[model samples]
Target: MSNLLPEEAEEKLVTVCRTAVGDSLRSLTYFNRFDYVQVYLREDLEQEADLNSFIGNEWHDFKMTQDAYRGSELGDYEYTIRVFENGYLVRITVEDFGVFVTTDGISMQDFEALAAATTEILDEWAIEE
Candidate 1:
């Protein structure tokens, strides 16, 4: 529902992610400060329909991530990857728009590709805005 992130870009992000991780993808959420889109979710996880609710709680936190390591010894914050027992969580924030993707076990290389593509897409849109 964000003017900065139309349905086409939302679908593009989902498509890029699926192409990167294929069937390992669990779900994807595209969000801005205003609202979020449940871009993709595998059928097996349909019963666990609380993902949006969970994401709602983290909007502020996700926004905070943008300034989190600003001007540190390391370069700017690109993305975040959290490993869990069963899968992984990837968060990429850009200006006011961002995406959070959940995926099953995937290689580090694939994760990097996904993050890079996701960041590039969001960054490009942010520039246009």
Candidate 2:
């Protein structure tokens, strides 16, 4: 299992996303879990090839629309939640580091909420106090 706490993980994800997209972002709230938030970016599809390449020949169970790509991984003591950014067709992946999130794409408010939710869930499985 991961040693990091959810809060800590979330912080890490925010840093990574911000670094990639920047601090100013646009977002819309479309879905939510107890500690998770689903956001839609305001951007349009930019890189269709790059986005399609990520899901090439891979089996994915989408949660939203047919355009959405989703997957999960379960290990001996680790679990991961992955969501691909469909906005701007930016093939961004949000990974929960047992407590936080890591992703690529432009910054947006929706992304912030997603990062927060991912961290909250990871916190429950942290290996660190």
Candidate 3:
């Protein structure tokens, strides 16, 4: 698949995610130099689900982790999903940017479906370029 520059990817992610899960999607944050992204979804989930929340301010810690290991591929380019009582979060490194996700009250199944749809859009965007 063709790749996208971090800023380009971040823009696409915002559009894709908004279309995919606008209702449950709380916010989208991307850090290009740090290669970080976050997607926040509404949360109301059960334990042992395929996805889990990061408990407490782990999302903040996550940002710190990205800040700490900014330029290294091994340190920064990993995907993390955290499900908390209020919501869920998805963090990933793409190119030189990072993606973060947060949910306010969405179920696990719905969140996954929305995320899949968002990813599809990103893939398609890459191919188009």
Each prediction's TM-score versus the true structure: 0.84, 0.26, 0.45
| lDDT by residue for model 2 (7-96), tens | 454455445445444633333111112122323233642322332223431213222322342342432222223455633322222232
Q: What TM-score should be assigned to candidate 2?
A: 0.26
TM-score of 1: 0.84
Angstrom error of the Cα, residue 52, model 2: value is 26
Candidate 1 residue runs with Cα over 4 Å from true position: 1-5, 47-49
lDDT of 1 by residue, 9-123 (tens): 7689888999889999998988777777778888888646576675665566765665676777888877888888989989888777788899999999999999988888888
Ranking by lDDT: 1, 3, 2
lDDT of 3 by residue, 1-129 (tens): 123245666567666776666766776654444233343333543323222233223445555776777897676335566778867766544333345666667666666666576556544654665
Per the 3 Å backbone cut-off, how many clashing residue pairs does candidate 2 have?
11
Instruction: Go through the candidates in order and give the clash count of each.
Output: 0, 11, 34
**Which of the predicted structures, 1 or 3, would earn the higher TM-score when compared with the native?**
1
Any idea what lDDT model 2 has? Answer: 0.34
Best by TM-score: 1
Candidate 2 residue spans exceeding 4 A from truth:
1-5, 27-129
In order, the Cα lDDT scores of the candidates are 0.81, 0.34, 0.54
